[model samples]
Target: MLKGNAYGHGASVTAAFLASRGLPLLAVGDLTEALDIGQAPQTSILVLSPPLPEQLPLAVRHRLHITATSPELVQSLSSLAQGRNQKVTVHIKVDTGFGRLGAAPEELVPLVKEIKKCPYLKLGGIFTHFPAAGGDRIFTAQQLNLFLKLKEEVCALGDCDDVLWHAANSAAFLTLPSSHLDLVRIGTLLYGQSPVSVGAEWDFRTTWQFKTRIVQIRTLPKGHSVGYGRKYRTKKPARIGVIPVGYSHGLELEPLTTPLRQIKHALGQGLKGQHFVFHPMGPLPILGRVGMGLTTVDLSKTPDVYLGDSVTLSMRRVTASAHVPRIYYLAGKVKCILANHEVLSPTGRKISLLGLF
Candidate 1:
């Protein structure tokens, strides 16, 4: 899945590399993200969510595999495709138990029949989402059982046995072997973050890293407060290093609004500590609230650390700011860089990541 800017790892660059390696289909959230991946003639792109009514034609024209969550949408898409003299591929979304976007179990037969009736539409795939597969085993089993029964029933109906079915998300793919049907729609697993602790045993390496350099360093008095609401105060004189990445860059801070909560946090800090940046010697504790563009880390322990020294943190990749540049490498060498709309090479030559396809 190359949705949410490839989980904030630069969609175009990731899609280009994956497509070059012969990825059959890349899924994105909507048409805009599909457009961001640019033109890849050989690779198929699936839009996981329903596009707007006005955007359906564009999706058909682009040959994007679209999601059909309802009979109404399937009928509308069929009309549009028929009018354009185009055959559009569609995946039927089955809401086995997720209770989100998807046709109900009872509606499956009619939905499939509707798709078969449309001469301009092809039933490419069927799929569901698992909201509790990561944590709730009984519920996940129920959902899986329901989907399996539906899949069998759908396939038993005329000419639908070959319709592809998928349900495994990152967590289901890892923990529930039965959930792996035709294909898996893994997001967190692809980025190497385990949805559950069982994944820690797997030899999955992270493909993304968040790093920034200290932009400012200064010493504050023993009782100096840091960040908004004076949330943190130094017990002794301390040195602080300011990092460029902050909440605006997708670093989340815990909300401490009440005075009691603030006091509890202050008491807990001495024992449990808080979020920190990694260094060779030790971890540097982050001081107080993360601001929009700046985060302060206590640097008293690492006196050798200076301004411009790199500070690294493990962040939720999907939430990171998309405007930040993503540098792609192959064989441990620089291949390309993507920033917003521009793609560049190591030598500073402008290029398009999609142009390679």
Candidate 2:
């Protein structure tokens, strides 16, 4: 599943790659994203939040599954479906106490009743989104309780049949299986990382990595200033390596992970450079300010390396601002590509982390 420019990983490209891996189903935030990847046969599409009536016809034609919540929209969908001589499959979203979408508990009775009469609309599934599936047990429990309640009600519907009840995203599927469900729409998990780092028990294996080379090396006298606004100054006459990826490329300098804390000392003999994780307990802590097209690597200790040496940036989804090519892999081999499609040479890799926000 992909949404919000795919949480910084491009949606269209990511969806295509996941589809290549037999993902089978995809969830998107809106109608546009749904249609973008809807045509693939055997691939189910879910528009997390769909648009209004005026904008839904094209999406229906593209074979996307629009998420339905209200009776009015369900009726509208049936009408649209009648015009197309097609039955529109809808994934009914239940709020499950998140106060977001789906019919409220009291409203479900009437909504389900109204939906059963729509001949052209099929109840593909019943589901909800968990607000704290990765962390809060209390809130997660409440949501799960509400989901089970609705599941019973939907199952009781006279003509509803056996609509799938799916309430788990990656977090819920991994940590809370009461909602493991008939189907799960996972994003970060398939990408092999946690969407949130703090308190998350991560088990998914990462599928890809990012790396670039140092374009140049510069040595400066002590106290020399560097970068725009001169954020960092050379304390001692030191050498700095210029990497070909920076903040503009989706890098967040300083500490991009969890609660930033100062470490006492690094491993090895006098490891000079300090290191930090993206989020406390985050799987990857590898990022530099995404430069216009480069990153500033502090290589004072590793100054003996040449300009052509490469540094791989372990990455999950970067921000939309990061307009770079994405290399994909499956089972330790190059499988597919997104953007430019420049084949990367590195075989062994690691996933680098940056904060979700």
Best by lDDT: 1
Query: What lDDT score goes with residue 135 in model 1?
Result: 82
Alpha carbon lDDT at 298, candidate 1: 95
- Residues 151-224, model 2: lDDT tens digits: 77767766556577788888887777777778887876766677555354545654544566667888878887
TM-scores for all predictions:
0.86, 0.75
What CA root-mean-square deviation does each model show from the true structure? Answer: 4.0, 7.4
Task: Supply candidate 1's per-residue lDDT for 174.
Answer: 78
Model 1 vs. true fold: TM? 0.86
Those runs of model 2 whose alpha carbons end farther than 4 Å from true positions after fitting are 4-23, 35-41, 194-204, 253-292, 314-322, 340-357
Query: On a 0 to 100 scale, what is the lDDT of residue 16 in model 1?
Result: 78
Error of 2 at 232 (Å): 2.0
Candidate 2 local accuracy as lDDT? 0.65
